[model samples]
Target chain A: MQSLIVDLGERSYPIYIGQNILCEALIKPFIKGNQVMVVTNDTIAPLYLDHLLAHLSGLSVDVTVLPDGESYKDLTHLNLIFDNLLKNKHNRTTTLIALGGGVVGDMTGFAAASYQRGVDFIQIPTTVLSQVDSSVGGKTGVNHPLGKNMIGAFYQPQLVVADISVFATLPDRELSAGIAEVIKYGLIYDYSFFCWLEENIERLVARDADILMQAIHRSCEIKAEVVAQDEKEAGIRAWLNLGHTFGHAIETHQGYGNWLHGEAVAAGTMMALSLSVQMGWISIEDMDRVRRLFEKANLPVTPPKNMSSNDFIDLMSVDKKVLNGQLRLVLLKTLGEAVVTADYSKEKLMDVLSA
Target chain B: MQSLIVDLGERSYPIYIGQNILCEALIKPFIKGNQVMVVTNDTIAPLYLDHLLAHLSGLSVDVTVLPDGESYKDLTHLNLIFDNLLKNKHNRTTTLIALGGGVVGDMTGFAAASYQRGVDFIQIPTTVLSQVDSSVGGKTGVNHPLGKNMIGAFYQPQLVVADISVFATLPDRELSAGIAEVIKYGLIYDYSFFCWLEENIERLVARDADILMQAIHRSCEIKAEVVAQDEKEAGIRAWLNLGHTFGHAIETHQGYGNWLHGEAVAAGTMMALSLSVQMGWISIEDMDRVRRLFEKANLPVTPPKNMSSNDFIDLMSVDKKVLNGQLRLVLLKTLGEAVVTADYSKEKLMDVLSA
Candidate 1:
């Protein structure tokens, strides 16, 4: 196993990445308490819950299985975890283990954050999307019907164990979804990693463990560095949200489950690049590279056909990034750099949406 | 206005205690954004909403008035604030102003904490209970049916403006409830404060502004000290919860609105004294002294008659204070000292519950 630390001072935690390493020996060191509650969803429970339980043997372990899908990420489903913890008499000293993809990890992390006004939680993200992205940051919360991730907290996890072996079970669509974020790291900050992704696209699709491990590790390294400096998105941390503003609008317009989070982000990344090109910040060649990467990963490169420019504007206007009533977005100044600003004109942005 | 700082480093904010200081000049300095959403309940809206609005002139201000009571402090009502925020396009930079008692303050604080993963909030606590306790700490959240404050976060406000003038409009029962917490500061950590309470109990009950200001200021001083050292309730902070474990049971058992938080805490404080006496930490005379203070404030001194020892055990067992499946409680060592531990006999606790 290879380890990288997300330096957050007292809240700093380690992210462990490797193949077939989900065991008690690996997870035990991070658990601060004796009581453990493993939270997973219906989709992920049967596949890996028992393996996780095997490692948690002889500890006070309880499990809560939620229904699968982003649509289920709401206050109602969040209550299931809360109800189980309260019912089983879990306390502040108990550690919650989120043992699934982003949906489960987000909700469980949020549950741990709010349970008794915050408890310890360990993340065992089991999908490519979660292992590389959601599980690494301390952003924990559930979505509101009015907006995605509308209610949440910046509560960190005790540890993150991303076992690449679990990615073998991920659906092709989901694996591609994870790649969307993988490409994002390169497009926004690292040209070499973008080129590395360009060369290893097929290897990643073929599920080569070594290449996949490298991608997850590199993505986490960049994220960890950004989070360390700006843990609360007070400044540069917002750079990591490059395509999320437009992506969330698509997800909200399409309804959460209809389009996966990374799928929406994939399309939104393209929109961000398009906006960059219109502003003369990047060459069409650079925009083409980002598009080709998403296409190569089998990710969506455009918003839904039915969504109008107005729909995008209305939804994006309410995005979390909006400040002082102006929509702030993370736009690429080049292939290897990103900046969050509202410097572009509305007509230019509308032109990209129209195209 | 007298100011005391809750020194939480970067999270630290000032607690302003005095009369008629709720103007735009006093409030505007702490607001991080121009968009302001004032959250109040129906009871407080009719009383102070106009005054709050006058101070918020020429800004983008919105208000959501929830039903007034502890029963309404749930996720549903929390969503009312969220709904209004989203509908009005309130961004993450928007500042949420909580202008009511503890219920409104708690929910609004949680809303700001969770809105787009956190926003700035200012507390204009109209109730003495909030001005002295909840407003000082970063503890913000809503109640669940199974338990009180089962769902929430430790999100702090930008500034706390405790307008003692509002207490003049407070109902007698509410004022008495606030006195319970004031008495708690004396009981747990200050012998002289306890003696002072013995002398000034009638003055506090009569709502003398100068005396009330002193009581609120002293209570905040002790609370701020404890919270600064252990902001997350990992150690000495638990001492501030001297009666909360038992008090939460009373609030949960009687149902939230049935027993005001201070009323239940008043009774719970007495029970804690009884437990202390059983453990030989205090004499019957000392217990009576504590009870007399509650009685003088016109606060409840006993739990509901219907709840059995089993009910208390089951509910307290699930309290936030429980550790490693053991019930941890904050009990008095003497009239002026408190400690939190699970190192007590079940028999003695049962005896107190039965009594």
Candidate 2:
């Protein structure tokens, strides 16, 4: 087992990565209060709720199992967590445990942030997608029908326990979805990690324990550093959304849960990379290198066939990335470097979208 | 005009208290973005919305007029703020201006807090209840059916423009409700202020402009000092909620809008003072002093005749003040001092409730 701390002053917490740390006593110290409410989903509840609860043994524990999928990640379902907490008499001192993937973690973290103003919560991510991305960042919120992640808070968790052993149960498509974010860390921030991902993509796909652990650790380290510097996404942190502007449009257009977040991000990242090539910032060969990595990971390298430039424009306008009336996007400046800019030409953007 | 700052480090903001300050350039400096959305209720919209919008002529401004009242201060109605924001393509750079009473302020502050994970917001509090209490502290949220303020955030506004001129149009009942909180600041922290309220209670009820301004300024000064020391209510800040635990129970029991928040708080404050008297912490004369002031302000000094001790206990258990299984109550050690304690005897609490 290895741990990395996300340094956020008083809000700083550690992310623990290991084979089966979920059953370990590592989470005991982080439970600030005697009362614990574990928020999971129907899919993960049947699989790991009891196991997680078993580890939470002497504390007064309650469970709220929401229906699975991003479609359920809305205010209506977010209320269910509040309902369960209040119904069971969970108070300001109670700690909420988010015991599933991103949706559960996001909702539960948000639930913790808003419950009686704010409360403590632990994240035990059960999928590769969550373990690599959502679990590390302090970003927690539910979706609005108008946009993805449209309503949320920058709330950090008490502790994040990412037991990769749970990923053995993740479907192949989901595994590739997780790798999409893994590839993102490389394309946006680190060239060496990008090369390493290129070399070890197959082993990660097969779920090799050590390789998967390395990938998760590296992704979190980069994310933790970015978050520590710019927790609220005011400046440099926007680089982390290399494909998210385009990706959110795809997710909102297709309706949430229809296209997995990382899958949409994968296609969105491709559009960003293509735009980068057209701008002459990076060569076609360099963009192709990142494209090959996404393709090898079995992720979508393009937007949906039916989605048009108009759809992308309309949906992307409402994205959180838009400042004033300008649509700013995270575009690659070169391999291993990214910049958020609204300076790009519209005709060129339209050309890339039409392509 | 008088201005004071709520010193919350980087999140600190100024509170401008004066007559008709809402129409001044005081608000423009606080707006961090070019887009603005003014969230007001029906009652206040017809009164002050256009006047507030006139000051924001150059910016892209939109208005969302919600039904007025505390009953509408819930998650369902909170969605309307988001719907209007998204429909108008308001992005992260948008600043939300809450232009009404506490209900509108709480919802707008929370909407600003949760919109795109947070945005800049300014408060133009028209009601005395909001100008003195909710506007000073960064406490923002909506209510749930099961509880009042069950869903919310501790999000501060960029600026608070408390235009006392608007109170001239307020009803007699609403005027008394605002006095309840003004009386609270005195009871919990300032014996001199309490004495002041006692002597000038009738003048305040008559809505004397100078006297109300003095009361609001003093109340905000005390609140700002307390909030600066403890922003999240971990310790000294809970004293600011001197009557809130019992007050929230009364509000929840009366079904939100049925009881104005300050009126319920007035009654709840009496209950706390009564319990304090029973505990031998204060003399009967001291508690009576407060009771008389509530009476003079046309506020209730006791719980509803139908509400039983069991109702108080059942509702208070879910309060944000409850820690673990313990029901902590804020009691006065004397006229100007308050302490949050779970050390009281249950029988004494029952005595106060049954009375």
Reference-based lDDT, each prediction:
0.90, 0.90
Clash-forming residue pairs, model 1: none
- Candidate 2's residue-wise lDDT over A218-260, tens digit each? 9999999998999999898999998998899899989898899
lDDT of 2 by residue, B1-355 (tens): 9989999988999998888666646778787788999988889888777788789978999999999999888889999999999999998889999988999999999999999899999988888999899998899999888888888999989999887999878998998999999999998899999999999998999988899999999999999999999998889888988788888888888888888888999999988988898889999999888898999999998888888989999999888878768888899999999999999989999988888
- Candidate 1, backbone clash total: 0
Clashing pairs in 2: none
What does the interface RMSD come to for each candidate? 0.9, 0.9
Off by over 4 Å in 2: none
Best by TM-score: 2
**How high is each candidate's TM-score?**
0.98, 0.99
Interface RMSD measured for model 2: 0.9
